[model samples]
Target: MSGWTWADVDVAVPRPGSGLPGVAMAGFRQRVRGDVEIAMVAHPSVTLFLDLSETGGIVREAGGTSRRGSFVAGLLPGRLRTGGQEGSGLQIRLSPAVASVVLGAAAELTGTVATLEEVWGRDAGRLEERLRDAPTWDERFTIATDVLARRLAVPSRVEPEVAQAWRRTQAARGRLRIDGLAEEVGWSRQRLWSRFRAQLGLTPKRAAQLVRFDHAAHLLAAGHPPAAVAGRSGYADQSHLHRQARAITGLTPAALATAPWLAIDTVAWLAAPRT
Candidate 1:
C-alpha cells in the first residue's frame, strides 16, 4: 500500500460537461512523503486559496513561493499563503469574469503580501483556524464569501473573447491541443500563451496537462489501469502518462493509486459560493 497521506473535500458544484470549475476543494498532510511537492497549480480562474498555518511558503504575488520541503507560490492572478497541511482551507475558483476584475484591482495592491486585515476582517492565520473549527460547511462558506466580497468590491466585467476561448478549452475536456486551442482562440501561439500566463498562472499546455493528470488520478483511484487511464485522458500512451504523473505530482500512478490518504470527498457544498 502507498504510504502517502492526503485527504480533501470537494464542496463545489460540478459544472455541466466539466466535473468542477470556478473552485476546487482539497486537504492534504505529507507525513512521510518527500517534502510534499505539488507541481504549480494553474487554472484560468483566479484562485482564492486559504493556506492553513501548517503550510508556509514565500509568496511573490506573481512569481511563487518556495519553502519548507514543499513549495507553493502565488502565480499570476491571485493567491493566498496562509501556511502547510495544518493550513487546510478552500480554493475559490474564479471564473474568467471574476478573474479579470480581481487581477485588475490587485495590480494596485501596495505590497507583496496578500493583505487581509482590512478586507478579510482579520488575518489569514486566524481565518484558517476559524474555518477549521467551524461546525458546519455553511458557516465556513459564509466566512469565505465574506472575505472575497470585501476584497473584490467590484464584480468582473466579462470578456467575451477570453470567456469564449475558455469555454472552448473546457469543451475539449482536458484533452485540448495547445496549437489548436491557440488557433481556435484566434490568437497566435505566442500571444495565446502570453495571455493565458498573464490571466492564469499556467501556459495553456500546462493547464491541460494538469487537467489530464487530475483525471487520470481519479480514474486510477476508480480502479482503471494506467494504460486505460492514459488513453482516456488523451495521453500519448501509458508510458507518457506515467512520466507525466511523476513529473507533475512527484508520485507514480501506482503509488498514488495505493496511497492510504488519497481519497477526496466530491460534494457540492464544497463548491457553494463563499459566504
Candidate 2:
C-alpha cells in the first residue's frame, strides 16, 4: 500500500514553454491506498480542481456545501476541505485578471464552489475524460494548456485599466495604495472601484487584503514568527496580523502555521515552474 502522506504523492508540472500569464498548472496523484482528507486554505486565485482518477474522485466542502468530482473554486472560498477514497487530479490556478476572461463568469463565481459542469456545461465531463485517458502527465498538461489557451483567446470583457490595477496590486503584495493604483491605471478612484468590483467580483480593497493574507499565510507555514510575518507582510502589527488572519481564514496564526493544505505547497506549487 502507498503511504498516507503527502510525500508519497507524485506531483507534475508542465514543461517549459510560452503560456498564458496569470495561470499555473500542477498535476497530483495520491499514492495512498485508501481514504484521504485535506483542509484547503484560501488563495487569491480562481482554482480549477480537475479530477482524473479512475476510482473514486475528489469531493470538496465549503460553506456547508459539498461538491463531488471536478469543481471550480472561486477566490477566497473560505475554510474549504477536500477528500476522497484515493485519487489523482490536475489543479489549475488562474489569477483573477485572467479568470475574468477565461472563465467568463469570474464575478459570478466569487466566493463560491461550483461543479465543473456548472461552469463549463458538458465540456467539463469531456475534459475530464480526455485527461483521464491521456497516457502520461505531459500529455494531459498539453491538453489542458491548449484548452486554456483557446479560452483565453476569447476577447476579454475586463477593462485594460481594471486588469492593470489588479496586476499592480499583486505586484506590490497588497501593500499598494488603492488611490495610487487608480491613478496609475488612469482611472478615477470611483471608476476603478466600480469596474473592479463588477469585473473581478471584489472591491480593490478586498483584493489587496486577500493578496496580503495569502503572503502572510505562506510565511507562517514556512515557520516564520507571526510578528515577523506581520511586519514583512505590511500589517500594522502582530495584533493586526492576527485579526486579519482570523477574518480571512477563520484560523489563528498558530493554527495556520501548521495547516495541512499549505504543507504541500512547497512540493506542489513552489517547486513547479509555471507554464
Candidate 3:
C-alpha cells in the first residue's frame, strides 16, 4: 500500500486460464491511417457493437458478426466471437491506470454489461477518433487514462489495503479469510466492506471470488485436470468450478477449454488490479 508506482503498474497479454468469459485484449483497427471499424457482436447472452471509430459509415458483416463501423473508447467484458472488417491500427493493452482513467471509480463493474447500444448512447465517436488517429499509442493511452482519472471523483479511492488483502488471498489460492484481512486493516468487517464497495464497487469477499475464478481459468488453460484445477483455484470441487464458470461466463469449462481467447482480459485485470 505505498502510493502507486511504476513497479506496481504492468501490462500483460491475456492469461488463458481465468474462467471469466469473453476476451481480455482491447483492440482498435484502422484500414487507412484513420479508417474506423465498427460492428455489432452477438453473444449468447448479449449483443453489442464493437465500434472502434465513428466515421465513413461502411457497414459490413462477417459471418454472424456485423460491422457498423463506428468509434470505440471503453469496452466491457464479454465473449467476443465476432469480428469487424480488419483495420491497421494497433490494439494496445492497458495498464490499471488506463482502466481506472476510463472506467471511473467502480471497484466491481459487473451487473451492468457493456454493448454497442451503450456506446451509441454515449456518442463514442469522439473518443474513437482520438484512439484511431492519435499520433502515438502512448498518446491514445494517455488520453484514455486522463479521461477516467478525471471522471472519477477520487482516483485512488480504492483502498490499497483491500486490494492487497485480495492479492494475498489470490496468491495463497484464495485461502485468506476476510476477518484476517479486516484485522490487518484495523477496521471492522462492516467498515471495510463499505469502503471496498464504494471505492471498488464489490465487497472484498466478492473480489476474492473474482480472483479465485481468474486463477481457476489460468490453471485450466495450462493443462491441469478439472479436479486439480478446482482444488488449486479454490473451488469446492469440479461441480463447484463448473457452476462458477457458467454463472460468470455463460459458458461451460469444456467450451472454454477449447477457447484460447476466452476470459483473456479477466486474468490480465485481476493479475494486476491496477485500476
For residues 80-168, could you state the per-residue lDDT of candidate 2 as single tens digits?
88887667899999988788877888999998888889899998989999999999988998898889889988888888888888877
Residue-level error in angstroms, candidate 1, position 27? 8.8
Q: What range of 10 consecutive residues in model 2 has the weakest lDDT sum?
A: 266-275
lDDT computed for candidate 3: 0.47
Single out the weakest 10-residue window by summed lDDT for candidate 3.
39-48
lDDT of every predicted structure (CA atoms):
0.50, 0.85, 0.47
Top lDDT hit: 2
**lDDT preference between candidates 1 and 2, better one:** 2
Residues 146-220 of candidate 1: C-alpha lDDT, one tens digit per residue: 654564577544445555556666566568777888787687888877766555445677666655676677678
Off by over 4 Å in 1: 1-21, 24-135, 150-159, 260-262, 265-275
True-vs-predicted CA distance for residue 92, candidate 3, Å: 7.4
